[model samples]
Target: MMLPLLEMTYKELADAFTEQYKKGPALAKALYGEFFKNLNPKAWQAEEIQASPGLADRLREDLSFSPGKIVDEIHQDGLTKFVTELADGVRIESVILPLKTHQTVCISSQVGCRMGCRFCETGKLGLARNLTVEEIIGQVYTARRRYGRSIRNVVFMGMGEPFDNFENVIQAVRVMSDQRGLNIAQRHITLSTAGRIDGIEKLAALNIPNLNLTVSLNAPNDDLRGRLMPIHNTVSMVRLQQALRAYPLKKGNWLSIVYVLIPDVNNGPEHARQLADWLQPLRAKVNLIPFNPGKNAPFRAPHETEIDSFRRQLIARQIQVQKRAPRGRDLMAACGQLGSGIRQQGLN
Candidate 1:
């Protein structure tokens, strides 16, 4: 089997290079550094490093460095969504969202999701399979190359439930944070999950520095949350709250609570108060996301006035809150809105 060079750690790659070519650490560093410069299979050039004839060719062929194939690309508004096809032909979507100062890429951890959140389009696809570390890292590399700018942030909010693919996601993040590779700071990465208490406990135990955690907490109480997210049936809101309270966070850092505001579902003033009360114990910032309209979705986006009123009600209780503006909805690439699609479209 060919070794996946892009999925390797600095030490692993360096050791492999040293062992393969009988070279010292110097050659290992040179070749390892080159591989990441472009992240292409042929990134390491022999003439540039004074390697023996055919050594670079051998290295490139012996160690497979290919990421996934880019099946299609679509740009909507300021966002560009890339459809990546893995070796098995399973496709996953990653979105490049351009903000005022920097760009953020939303990557998928799984090919499909099983959480079955009523508001999420991805959930409707059912669970396909969890992506390997190489597959997850491929999305970041693809986005950085296509966007022609450094990605400032990464969110595991694209397709599947990240926590379900815990090990691979963490390994990918480690490779991404390595200074030799993508070199993304831990603070710039955030992992969002649908109230998986066990996953939250594991993350807290790992104490991964600066990696932010966001809970897809759409409803304030158990009954409503269970109605919205079926996972709540197993891990109730109270259990999730207890886990969040126990989860370790850096000083002054707060967990992000995502409240998807559906028109008549969970957008009442009382809901806001209950949300505020629920979050009062734990340090958290609320991101009120109006439901993005989707195919056959049972809910509609709340009115602007209702969104404003909800934010105000939370603020009145001394909770930090912000209304998340919808992006890439036209392309079905916004929050809770990634499904299998192939037609290409772009927006200027």
Candidate 2:
């Protein structure tokens, strides 16, 4: 089988070039620049390839470049949710979020989610499979090259629980943050998880520089959280908090705790106090997301007054909190709103 060009990191690509073609690191660097920076596949045919003989033919014979095709693009208020059909016909949705300065692409780590969060639309569709490295990176590439998006940040908060597909997600991150390739700074990349302790420990061991970790913590107490998120049944809030505390965060960096404020379910004053108390020990900020009601959603969004009151309650307890504004709701691309609707329609 031919090696996947998109899956290989700079070091692996360099080693491949040196071992297969007896080319130096410079050739690998040039090839990496052409493939990732320049977004060119035929780097060996470019003028820079003069230094490395037979490199073009070697790449042609030994490497494969396959990217998912964008079948649908749904545009809403400054957000475009694009669906990419993979080689195996499994489809995934990714959202292009418009920030003030630069764009952020919310990419999926799996086709459907197994986390089974009661409030999320993606959880409605059971896990199909984990996306390969190419499929993961292809989302960003398609956003940048095909749609002409100026993507500055990437978030793993789209479809599946990122830590469940830990190896592939981390490999994709390495390929993305490679200086010679996508070159997205580690600080610009955010991996959101639904409280997976083992994955948290593994991430701490790898210690990717400046990578931001966001925990999808909806409820404050164990009983409420377990009811809202099934993952809590296995990984409790206590263990999750311990893992977060052990995570090696650089100076000036803090964890982002995402609390999806479902009306009456997890938005009461007592819930807010419990959440604040739970977060008292950690250097973390709360991103309060008012639930975006999806199809057949069991919970409704909190009223504006309730949302404000919850925020104020946290603030009163000296917690740093920011209310997340809902984006791409009409298009079903908002937080906890991504699902497999397009795939079910057989759009591919």
Candidate 3:
């Protein structure tokens, strides 16, 4: 149990205030005061650093992503670890994916999820609530203390429907990209949505480079997309493709098309061809993921032969295709696997 006297980090302070005490603006201010008090006074005294405007902006703004957080165990194992909890019966999981090069924190944007997809564990719980900006960003600070370094990348693909929690999600993204704190480049960040039509437009307006905006495109046709993801029932593939084309994207920036290959479901070479045909016009890349099985998730991954066949088919058509290495599986860290501990402990 945390003592009332513990020197809480910015995130800890916010969680205590919003989730526990129910105060909003006042708690946000107090958290800011605490942050100002802890900032290192001797950070920017170097002569070369003072000469560059870009460097100054980085120091003052983009670096302030996760305030008042630290890694407790992220650095020791050189791998990610998560802490699961529930406030008012809503499941929340925080992840820190670590590597030799840099650490990345995967944070959730909502409790459970309203965008119920067939393959996601979080969505199965249904939507409880959209997390506040502070609640979303707090996970970063908590991971930092456990791990020991500022994370190099942030992927908003953890446990919730990031776009469904649009306003708060963007606010958290803004704070994370702020220069006054964590100076992470927006390019190094990624956001995945099941498929939210309006959210894609908003992201396009942000115009942040190398922001890997990904869509979970699991099917070749509307019928299949609707079957895999319930959101497609409303925002069909045809409409999603239209929204994606409207986005002002960089030349080389491809809208990452995430295809979860499940046995006999969406794992055939013909399905691959159909998908490629559907996406040939869009500036996009296909990331073939062998479905990560979760609790009560009926889907199973395709055979390696089937996966290779699909990848080759996409590549033959000159579509940029790559297979993403699944991470944190040992610790149940893949997408939709983060909340098992909470369930086991009866927290949610």
Candidate 4:
């Protein structure tokens, strides 16, 4: 006879163990091992678990542990989500964005970021830790099971720097994109980075087709960039631009040059000219992201008139530019703003 398989995730298993045995993961593991002591390892399979039937109350009463808010979000898609809190404390925030067209799962490479880009909320937390390969892939599995939606896009612009944790980051990417696994089309995937020079060179070697890139270029030059994004001080503008110019991927659309326009800092006409002069020869389209300050950020959005003038400069220079509108602000979930507790804390 085939052995009975355990249907719960690592998180659920750990949680259940704590409730029943009162403080012993080993005891729980041994008990669970006994429960599945039959013979067929190959038959054990993973599935998206949507419902818990009547086990919720019992489990809650026993363990006093509950699903995180992100778990609720996943279930909103009418699918099952299974999350695993890895041995490491690197919290993985993930969800399957279910839409009529396609499904996309956002994955975090690090628990937090060390880059400390002033405009980003995740950067404010300080660096916690880098996620392992299994943790990175867990985000995908959780999303796939919860909504039964086919995830088409994989964006690296989540909780941490994908390139900083290069080895695991690349390994996870390879595993997730493999034909035997998620098999998501390269065209639908994008990797966003805050200008990591060596990482750029490493990515260039892959030369994966249809894999798009987005560089966070908030300032036009070294002086301004160094002020807003400390990474600029470490990775000089000359080196970053050289990386962009020599990026291995063949052409399609210009790589997205994300420029976050703070109210008075990078919004003036002179700033635009400087930006245009720098970008006129680069192979990229500019994406103007109006600065939306977080709880502790010292920034504000630019005025419409000032933004219009900025766009005109790029257009006049024959450089493609698009001022991207802010979305999910009601949830503190816009560009340059993620995991900021804007939603749950009701900070608005």
- Highest TM-score scorer: 2
| Candidate 1: residue 342 lDDT (0-100) | 30
Ranking by lDDT: 2, 1, 3, 4
The residue-by-residue lDDT of candidate 2 on 1-348, one tens digit each, is 466878989999888877877878987888788788888766666566755566577677776777788888988899999888899887899999888888999999998988899999888887989989988998887788865547979999999999999999999999999988988899999999999999999999998859999999999999999999998998777888889889999999999999999887988888988999899989999999989997778888788898899999999999999998887678899998887465356433
Show where candidate 3 strays beyond 4 Å: 1-78, 84-89
TM-score of each: 0.94, 0.96, 0.76, 0.73
Tens digits of per-residue lDDT, candidate 3, 105-208, equal 88787777777788876766677677767567666645554555557688887778788888777766666665435545778778998888888988888776
Report how far off residue 36 is in candidate 3 (Å). Answer: 8.1
In candidate 2, how many Å is residue 44 off?
Answer: 3.3
> What RMSD, rounded to one decimal, does every model reach?
3.0, 1.6, 9.1, 9.9
Q: Model 4 over residues 1-348: C-alpha lDDT tens digits?
A: 111112333344547556653545654344333222211122112111113233333333433211222322424223222333445423445544555787766667777688888888878766778776656765664555454436678778777888899888777666556543355567777788999988888888887757788898888788989988898898787788888888865656568888988878888777888888777668788988888777667877677777788888779878889987654444455566665752233211
lDDT of 3: 0.67
- The deviation in Å at residue 316 for candidate 1 is 0.4
Score candidate 4 by TM-score against the native.
Answer: 0.73
Name the better of 1 and 2 by TM-score: 2
Report every candidate's CA lDDT.
0.83, 0.87, 0.67, 0.64
Q: Give the alpha carbon lDDT tens digit for every residue of 1-348 in model 1.
A: 456866877887768767776766666666666666565556557355555667666766777755788887898888888888888777888999887788999999987799989998888778888989988988888777778547868999998888999999999888888887778888999999998899999999999959999999999999999999999999776788899999899997889999898978898887887888899889899988989988666888788898898888889999999888887778888899876463222110
